[model samples]
Target: MMLIPTEKRLDADTPPEKRGQMRDGVRLLTYWSDSGRIVHGGFFQLAHQLEAGDVLVFNNSRTIPAELKTVDGIRVRLSREVEDGTWDGLILGESSKKLEFMHGLKALVTGPGTEPPLVRLVFSCSSSRLLRELYRQGDVIRYEHVARSWPLQDYQTVYASIPGSVEMPSAGRAFTWRMLAHLQKHGIRLAFVTLHAGLSYYGDDKWPNPALHPEAFSIEDEQAAIINDAKANGGRVIAVGTTVVRALETASDGNTIIPQAGVTSLYLSRTSKLTAVDGLLTGFHEQEASHIDLLQTFAGEEGVKAIYKEAVAKRYLWHEFGDMNLLMRQERS
Candidate 1:
């Protein structure tokens, strides 16, 4: 496992809003795979680094309030709703056969999930009532790195509309409406897909295997066409986050993307071959987090190691609310 040394690990304890900066005011680190070149700048300078015809594919999955507490104060984070109406969740503390919450609502632990610390929850209330309660009572799920709780709006991206993700597709968080408009005006193409991001970590330093935790995603016909056309015209398809990369790659048949909506348990790594995405824009991840493995698929193990080394040296923050990394392969001639 690739690990960031303890002394080099940096955390972003606060969001930009609390720091009195605009959403787009964070730092950006751009790396070119082909030339081994790196550039440092503010996120506001993003448009200047891209050329016309390059397509930026963003995940429009909005963040949902997924963290809830049982009557005894045990934390439960909803991962996703399965076809049978039961929800898969991660139990932060020890759990019993049933979990009780406010309003006399209770959920029975149906069985073990596909992974550790995950359990299938069947609530006593109806799906609609459970959803209502979740929205009314649940807080946005955050880790130890985040110092305090923030509103759900703070976790959502500016363009987010479809609400399903347990956590925010945070790589897109730095983008403001004005910046998106500027990209369009500068002739960069934009496309959107929906990938309800699942939990990245299970409690107690445990993590779910990306290949086992399925995330639902949708790529509409129009968006597929836009990406295909961009590639045909010699433009790069840049995924805004690792979630976007998984969704696009899941729908890809060779170099062509097929419009579809489904669940993907795709795990990308250095050995994985990417057929649809040429670039990635994402946040700095933890040392052993699966995201680091995904990054290796884009820049290789050595390349990603170099990028992380540089990022640490530059004192870049890590986590959902931290700095950004934009990795792109040299454009095909």
Candidate 2:
């Protein structure tokens, strides 16, 4: 496992807005797979890193206020909604067969979930009612590193329109409207896919396995056509986050992407071969997290290790509010 030095573990506790900085001001680390070259710059320089024919695929999943507190002060983080309308959630503290929340809402712990600390919860109200109550009583899910509570709006991307992700698909957080307009003006295409990201952590140092934590994703016909046409015409398909990569790879059939909507538990690692995506722009992940494994798929083990080492030495911040990394394959000859 790649180890992140303690000094390099600094958290970006404040959002860019709170720091009075533009969203695109975050630092970016770029890695070219073919040449093993790394470049460091601000996120606003992203347009200059790609050619006019390149397409950036973004995940439009919006963050929801997923952390709810029980009357007894137990924190419940909703993971995802199941087909039966019940939610799979993580109980932060000791849990029982039943949980009581404010506003007279209650939930029955149906059974154990797919993993520890995860339990199936059947709320006393309907899904829609539960969502409304969540907005009324729920707060944005914050990890221990976040210094204070921020508004739910702070966790959403400028282009986010669909509301489903429990946690923000945060890799796209640094993108600004101006940056997007500049990219489009420079002839770089942008496409969006919906991937309602699930909870990344399971409490108590436990993390969800990407292969087991199935997230729901949808690719529209037009989006698929854009990606395929880009690839067909020698344009690179750059995934904005691992969520977009997972969605595109899941929808792909031997290098061609077919539009569809479904749940994906696809896990990519060094051993995995990417069939659709040519590059990735993502946030720095924890050392042991599966996200590191996904990065290996693009840059290989040694290459990823080198990139991480450089990032740490540069004092780049870590986590959702942290700096960004862009890994791209070399252009076709």
Candidate 3:
């Protein structure tokens, strides 16, 4: 059941649409024994795992059109789609090229910049409407790889709502409409909050520079009220992804969860105290990403390592189109 297979395992036994689905296929984590030995189960049992009155908070932040471009035809991957027209382009060519990027601000992509060279564009106007159009027309956002452009629906998570993220907050992608309906039918109400995920490029590899992230997000009032009400009613507040956790945790006052509407540069580390979420639904992030470190706060180091090892052993796919992990509430038995 290892998830870190070099090959894709989401489609091992499933059909085209059935792959990576909650009911059809998903890697589930549960306590298998009284000794607290958590084990992997099928995702179909997830609904059964939750009680009726639970509130599932979904990060409905929709993804945007993000890509990289270059002038010299060298590799420069776009990780952070910074704004309406700019991207934090990674120069695979060299570190010096990235520092020299400010020099070529006028060089624009003429005919849809291809990848490898990572030709970044600074649109003169709002092209976010084009991304909305692509979704409406059911066209995948085209990103150049080397010579050919690649279209991707993989950036759209199943629970995607308000569009903004450069990449999909894929932890909740496995939840199907049927699963959501089932949760609702059982009185498990749901609401969405927006926390548009910024560029995941810098990762933990580079030094800390919070200012380097040109993007942050805001949550609406109604969404906040719903979450607070759920928590007040003794109902479990479940976050769909790490992005949701960051959004809610950022808005919290350590005593009361407020209806916050502002930009959050708050980076939750292993030592950060979590206040809002009772349960977390997330995918297996890469070891290099700081997400694993954030998860250590959710479950201690032992718990984090246990689930991670299970994911690696379960063969779940990594990245956006991958299987997910569910961390339930732990109580002293």
User: What TM-score fits each model?
Assistant: 0.96, 0.97, 0.74
CA-only RMSD, every prediction: 1.5, 1.3, 6.5
Query: What's the lDDT for residue 104 in model 2?
Result: 95
Q: How badly does each model clash, as a count of residue pairs?
A: 0, 0, 18
Candidate 2 stretches greater than 4 Å from native: 331-333
Query: Model 2 compared with the native: what TM-score?
Result: 0.97
Candidate 1 residues 206-232, lDDT tens each?
887898899999999999999999999
lDDT of 3 by residue, 1-333 (tens): 222444433322222254434433666676321244665677656776677777888888777654323344444434444456665444444433232221233324433222323346554334464344334432223222112333455556677877667677767666778877877888888978878675564322442233334345566788778878888887877788877887788888775567766666667767877888877887665554367666766776667767766666666555555566777656332
TM-score of 1: 0.96
TM-score of 3: 0.74
lDDT score for candidate 1 against the true structure: 0.88
What do the candidate models score in CA lDDT, each in turn?
A: 0.88, 0.89, 0.59
Residue pairs clashing, model 1: none
Off by over 4 Å in 1: 331-333
Better of 1 and 3 by lDDT: 1
**Considering lDDT, where higher is better, how would the candidates rank from best to worst?**
2, 1, 3
Sorted by TM-score (best first), the order is 2, 1, 3
| lDDT (tens digit, per residue) of candidate 2 on 1-333 | 656665667678888777888889899999999999899999999987899889999999889899999999998999998855599998887878899999899999999776666788999988888888889999999888897998898999999999899999999999999999999999999999999999988766688887778888999999899999999998999999999999999999987999999899998888998899999999887676687888889998888889888988898888888899999977444
Point out the worst 10-residue segment of candidate 3 by lDDT. Answer: 138-147
